[model samples]
Target: MRQNFILQVILSILIVTMPVSAETTIYRFTKIIDGTGEALLARDIAVESGIIKAVGNNLDRSSNGNLVDMGSLIALPGLIDAHTHITYGLPEAPKGNAWGELGATTREQRVAAAKRNALLTLETGVTSVRDLNAGGGIDFELRDAINAGAVRGPRIFTSGPGIHPANDPSPEGTDKTTPEFLKAAAEKRIESGADWIKIFGTTGSADDLTSRAYYSAAAIKAAADVAKAAGKRITVHSYGIEAVDAAITAGVTSLDHPVGLTENHIKAMKAADIIYVPTIDHNRYYAQHSEEYGYDSNVRANLRVFVGRNIETVRRANHAGVTIAMGSDAVLTGFGENTCELRAFIAAGMSNAEAIKSATLNGAMLLGQDNDLGRIKVGYTADFIAVSGDPLTDINAIISGVTAVMKEGVLVVDHRTGGKVNKPNCGTLY
Candidate 1:
């Protein structure tokens, strides 16, 4: 009897540790875009061990697993939002500040904010994101917690804080910024577990400080050096030509908000292979719907310049053979306007396919997860979303919630008329 009880316990552990079977669960769909910049096709996909094992015209699905038959639906690799603030919606900013002057809150409060947005973003088929700004390394902490199964969220690649030029004007009476202070701040962020370093080369007019002052090239270099020594690349936020030059000299890996990327800047970027994450969505969305976000007349007037300048800048970037990735600084005000960035990219003369790539594969590459997450290929993680109509024919289909989801080998959301479904939990482990 004792021997039999021990045998039963061992069998239970094995059953829990191993997948139920080796057979693949097939998802049959009428249209599939394999995420290789290839044309869409009518095909079936096979998933096993949480990875795509096969995808073709006639994939054999003989074994038993849950069969998801999506008829007339268009499927593609999960969308990736290259830039997002998973926590902290756009709160009303005072006249001088652009919502960046929120009171410093506890890390726990910030983590809660991030988790809420992470789940919402995941449901929108953005299976992954690179969070550009957060109060502290709290965003990174959130990512670690989620990956460790302590919290639920989309795959996160985060830059803990927005490092700024020390000389930039701070809020009233604050001590002036110095290179030494800036370097110390950078090191502190790195030590705090930042995945990537984010440097602000210039003080944008959008900040309370009106002057578009840039960090000295030496100062920018210091921040970049610290990031490199810590084994991470630096992402610089710049909206002026001079600042762009400083970023280039500093060897920044990516430039965000290139509101004035000149022809020379473009050449340098391509030469350095530095990617551009032009946040066209913020400009486009704010121009069209500033009122929705509670922007009064004065704020709206200022935003007009932001929109016009960004449009011209994007046009120049596209003409110069520079690589551009999509970034929607889409906040609470611009929640569903993520796809508007795609439309603006298309409007700026980028080919439809190129714009799509910016949001999908290009984003994955930007986050350095190209091998595992970007395309729908054999052995890649199963992260994909489905829409009601063909995205190629109508890019707006991606914007609408035809079937917003993250298929990480398991259904995260099924808004298909049935009641909400919760994340899976243990049920006796058998």
Candidate 2:
């Protein structure tokens, strides 16, 4: 009887002392669509300590964390918008203020807008974004704010001030200074913690009602050099063929527009290994709904030519073996409709897989964050979104319903009702 009592005490002690396995927040999905080129599979992904711990079948639910049973959902890396001016929208300035107003907006107002835009963008499943320009180094502030947990938003990579010549006319208030001044101004932006440099190398047809010719090759090269010296890349905005050629020759890392690119210019971009991000949505939208955007007829007609020509250009570039990254120049109001851009790419003749790559892995590579951001590999950041149908079959599945969104192992937006699970608490881990 005494021996039996001792055995009972020992058993009770053992039961009390044994450690309960840590809850790892296991997300059991009927489908796991890793961003890598590999095919999707059924598996459970585990997250804990704000990192993805494991991914496989029959994951131990209690050993890891809470279980989110995603029945038959398709998952992929969270979307990245390669080029965006989220903090600000197209200005209503009549004309001639493109460079001036951009520079004149107060730092305080710009910072506030950046914060608001960041939150709104995150709710739509944009886990990351690149802010190409801000009037006076305000983007950096927004980036810091997001990082410091003061805001709920996508990770921000920003360009402090888009370097351009002074007093050059445009309605967007873009900076348009000379090359010498551009280099100086770019350096200033870098000092203010710009992630990249934005350079305006050419004038568009209706850019601030300008019929003026684009900037020279030498001038664009000068700006690129300045950005390179600052240990950053320069992405140039060029609507004219001359500007495209100059940007390529000047070693600009990326070209934003190929509006009037010639055959030679296309070959040049391919040879130089430059990435082109043609914002086809704007052109397509303008083509179909010019009156809605209120653009002039001549400008609208010019856009029509540019849009169709660009579709052919993309096909030609693909045939010519040029690298491409996807970006929608259009502002996203919500998640489900964001896939409109991918459909646009398909309409332009790209395969569905190719379009998906342009959005996921290609975008991460463009930001130079591929190591920790893009794919669904074990070590990468746990940034992913899930939908009901197979995105592989229909790229449009991405926007249908972002059933779930995870960033750094935390569930930010759970689309059961098209609402966020909770406002992201960037400062907390638990």
Candidate 3:
């Protein structure tokens, strides 16, 4: 009897400790966009064990799983935000005190606000995000929590604390801003579970809207070398022509917010196969919400000029065949509204299909997740969103028509029948 009891106890322990298998789910869509700029087609996708098992016209119904009939909806691979600050929210600006708003909130309050922001982001069909920076390693904790299913945010690739100049909000805290110090900063981020490293190659919008290179070519290369050796990618926050040129020459994976990129800069980015994420929406948001953010007249005027110039820059880069990826640079007010950047790309002369690819396959390429996360194919992760109408004809449908979202074969947002459905009992989604 004692032996039987021991055997039962051991079996129970094994069952409890083993990873639980995810339920197989079969989703049938009326129209499908594979994220390759392909024409939409009718298809049925079968997902088993959180991976796409098959995708075809008629899949076998023999598999034991939930069959979700997404009626007459246009399906596309889940959207990805190449740049985001998930830990920040729209601050209630006191009179003439934009910076002080952040100081008023406690760490716990900021984290809780971040969680809320993540859920809103997912609801907009953004299944993946690259969180560039957050203070005190909160971004890392948020990423881990989402991955472990402890929270319900997007699949996050984070840089815990970015390497910035002393004038920036989150500086590297190094004694000297040299090549060696920058490399050490990158290494520290890697040791802290950073999937990528972000370096501020130029000044920020709040400081001065110039594209002066903060880090020299040597410094950028040193940081990039360290990240590459560790099998990680590096992106640079650059706005000026000099900074863009230096970042591209240093072999950075992507150059974020290259507002002052020239013809030479575009050519170099193309030659190096470096991605250009012109976060036009970032400036647009600031300009639109200038009064709310307590921006003075000069600050607001700078934003307006930069917005137009940035749009022209994007048009020039796209015309020159530079690879472009959409990043909202969405911080507080633009969390769930990240898709506006895609529309900006369309306005910059890209076709609707091209703009969509910027947010989908191009984003996957930046993260080195092209084979698994960006496309709706056999053996890919089951990450997709459904909309009410075809996005090809009216691209605005991407933002307005999101109906259902599924990540890893599990439904997270269902807005059919005009009622929003978030994940029940899911800490992050709710």
Candidate 4:
């Protein structure tokens, strides 16, 4: 009896440690735009264990797996938004205070709103984003939940809270005026689980439009140093020539808004190999939704001026061979409309293919996720979107042409059949 009991225990242990076979998914597409600026062609993609297993003209369908026929649709890598605010919302006008909106919501309400925003964003074919700011650790918690499969949303790389200098009279616990203090602030963000460090290198917003450097070069460098030591990247919110120069000199990973950038600034950015994320669509959004956001005529005028100037800067940067990444800087209402920036890039003299690269390959490089998320290669993650028309011919297809969205081999949105394939955790918000 004792020998039989020991044998039974050994068998149970072996069974517990055995690896389960991963489900395989096969997707057949009529055309594939691999996000490498290569020519488009029809192809088949096979995914296993959430990673792409094969890509070829004719894949064998004999294996027992889920088969998805994306008939005649243009398949492209999943879109990426390099800059965004996941937990921010614009309050309704007539009763909304732009500044007061930040403090009005409770933490629970903000998290709920973020979940809704994530669903809306995912439906638009954006499978990844870098959220720059959120208060009270909400962004961190949201990111963890998504990674744990407890929530359905895009992959998130977030900076818990942006660091900035205190107002005059220097509020307590908010002193970022010195290099030492800036370094400490960056370390604190890392300790709080921030994937990247964001610094307010210049003043911005409707209240003030002047692009002046708020932090000296030393301070910016100090923060960059800390981020590098911790194996993280740093992005700076900068505008104008002086602030842009300061950020470049400090070796920042990306510069947010360079509306005031001169030719000299562009040259410096190219020399430093810095990435530029011109949030041109953000300015246009405010200009178009002036009344909705409670902006006055002057604010609208300023935004329009900035939009034109920002586009010109982007053209100059592209011509100079500077890496440009797409970032909408979209707030709450702008979630689903984030792809509008891709259209803006085309209007700024970039070819349709180049604009798509900015949203896909270039974006992945900016987030340091190129190894697994950017291109539709054999070893990369199976994150892709399908549109009805050829995006190469018509850039508008990126905005209104998304028919299906697949992230990690799971179909989240399938507009072809008039409904989503796999229902998201939070139901449709729009």
Candidate 4 displacement at residue 111 in angstroms: 0.8
- 189-231 per-residue lDDT for model 1 (tens digits): 7887877888776666332324364556777788788888888
Tally clashing residue pairs in candidate 4: 0
- Candidate 4's TM-score reads 0.88
Model 1: lDDT equals 0.68
Q: How would you order the candidates by TM-score, starting with the best?
A: 4, 3, 1, 2
Ranking by lDDT: 4, 3, 1, 2
Q: Which ranges in model 2 have alpha carbons more than 4 Å from their true place?
A: 1-23, 90-113, 166-179, 205-214, 260-264, 286-293, 296-301, 331-339, 417-430
Candidate number with the higher TM-score (3 or 4): 4
- Model 2 over residues 204-224: C-alpha lDDT tens digits? 522232223356666677767
**Estimated TM-score per prediction?**
0.81, 0.79, 0.87, 0.88
Query: Can you write out model 4's per-residue Cα lDDT over 4-69, one digit (the tens) per residue?
Result: 989967754443333322366668887888777554443667778778876654454445556678
| TM-score comparison, 2 vs 3, better candidate | 3
Worst 10 residues of 1 by lDDT: 421-430
What shift in Å separates residue 10 of candidate 3 from its native position after superposition? 50
Model 1, runs deviating above 4 Å: 1-23, 40-42, 61-66, 90-109, 165-181, 205-211, 287-294, 418-430
What overall lDDT goes with each candidate model?
A: 0.68, 0.65, 0.78, 0.79
Candidate 3 local Cα displacement, residue 158, angstroms: 0.7
Clashing pairs in 4: none
CA error at residue 244 for candidate 3, angstroms: 1.6
RMSD in angstroms, all models? 11.3, 11.0, 11.0, 10.6
